[model samples]
Target: KAEVDTSALQNEAIQLSSASGHADVVKLLLKNPRVDPSEKHNFAIRRASMKGYVEVVKILLDDERVDPSVLNNNAILLASRYGHAEVVKILLTDSRVDPSADNNEAMLWAVENDHSGVLKVLLGDSRVDPSEQNNYAIRRASELGYVECVKMLLQNSRVDPSCRSNNAIKHASENGHVEIVKILLNDPRVDPSACTNYAIRHASENGHVKVVKILLQDSRVDPSVRDNYALRHASKNGHADVVKILLEDSRVD
Candidate 1:
């Protein structure tokens, strides 16, 4: 006969078992009336989700006693951050889970970590707003050179590439992500000249020859916009290629 130890020890064991992906043990522990699955600030579920333990999360969610949205929707956020696409999908199906909670932090983590699968899942959720948090998702993805993630975010009609969310183009150009720069420019909504020449200046300072050339080629981007800032930065950084390219632009003073 199995004796029920309804004490604090039982709860700890449940958490440990859940975190370790012991789905069977978690199911057994949840059956006990004295054991609390959501105890300890939802630690068990968060750990399981963070580690991509889909079965463990499923078991916890089935218990009805477990709450996925508590603690700032941490389960979804952690799962997205770790690229647990399946886990994220499961959580999104629950009505209690808010995909846009905490200012859509889940999306932010997904974009920043380049979790393309997780991002795709989030985008499918009608409640998720890709442009939330001041378009932080695309900006961060662009800056980090997460090409796939940026592409996914851009596909969402709700996202305005030209919204000027912290000047994503500038960040992309500054980080020397040439392909990303081209993608953003293709959107037509994004103004290559929006950042007062910071985009070109940053690319020039960082010696990004390809990025500077691309910016110069855009008719909308005036090469001389920032009082020759780009030229000075290229010369100061000793980027002979960038300097040459900028000097070739008749607009650069």
Candidate 2:
């Protein structure tokens, strides 16, 4: 039978040390004969990884007793989600670590949180699928107005440049991300007509005159399409600048 009292104390000490990011405490505690570092769960490593404790993580990972492959509460996922780029890099060195594990949730979390530093590391790895159609990192970055993130994802050949199902251009326009709008507009694959009048309408409705001007410059975008949707939205929303720009198109009825 396990020494219940000793085991409880060890577990509590390790967890606290890991959570507090005390590398010295973790090392000293691991030296205790009664402490079972070999526990399959490896709670210490997980906590250290999640908290971005680089030294603590390294110490825990070096222990042969700690298993990095345990599926539940994945260390890499947590580290990536929290934007711990250094911790993630350290974890990736272990053959046991699967950065792409957990259905690419690590990458998705990195994208969602705008962890650009972590994202660079993740994108360079062959294991990360930047173009996972279902996850759509590009779409998420575009919608969130992460221009740099979007640019990085676009470099991956797998990612579709066109504003497809995720409405990359539409969301960027709606949120008035002018730079992102410019980038998407410059992509040949992106059809301005793809979102119907969504791009101009949302830009107008939100009173984004600059974005409306950028869209107007795109010869592919017909401002008067959808029964003059841009004009109606700009007029109704009291966006005089956007309305004036739309009316100048000469196609507004």
Candidate 3:
């Protein structure tokens, strides 16, 4: 009968620690000689650490049975994704922790979610590669107009400006980010004309006349590129003024 009650208490302590990050409860449970600190529960120290409960995490780490090396990459990954900077710092300091591990997927998650604070930590850790793109962090930031994040990524020497599925320039241009477009254009590695035609078509089709005009100004941009859709789009979208500009270019009869 006593054994059953102790078991129930241990389970409850684990639950409480997982949810509340209350170190007091955990310490009380640890006092029970029968309670196994190392016993794997659905919620463990890793969850507490990810939640930024520094005190509870410290208690769990002090337990001889508790393994600091436990790979809760998913939980740590979530913490980083949500901008839990302190939690990430604790996790990364463990010698067993692999900052560059998981094929850069964690960094990708942070980037895609616009967790700029987490991204700074990840990017600063030389272990993390900036070009890893399963999450398309840089391009996604540009597309969503997260200008500060985009700027940070671009400033990183390791980040490949052109390394993307759609290319940052095209994404910025098509999304009507004139500022981002200008930034990408200034990079020597970015081919001003790389996706100009496609961007022009998309901008015109979407009635983003200002974007079209910006692209046209690029000396590399071929205004004569036969983009029937652009003309058709301008006509359909009631951008007659833009249509007039295209008509005057002498590219369309």
Candidate 2 colliding pairs, count: 0
Order of models, best lDDT first: 1, 2, 3
lDDT of 3 by residue, 108-225 (tens): 7777787888888888788888677533667777777677678888888777666643477777777788777777777777664565466666676677777777777777765556
Candidate 3 backbone overlaps, count: 0
Per-prediction TM-score: 0.91, 0.92, 0.80
lDDT, candidate 2, 145-240, per-residue tens: 998898888888878866364388888888898899889887788865666768877888899998889988887778887888888878888889
Give the least accurate 10-residue stretch of model 3, judged by summed lDDT. 1-10
* lDDT (CA) per prediction: 0.87, 0.82, 0.69
Candidate 1: which stretches are off by over 4 Å?
A: 1-7, 31-34
RMSD of each: 2.2, 2.8, 3.3
Higher-ranked by lDDT: 2 or 3: 2
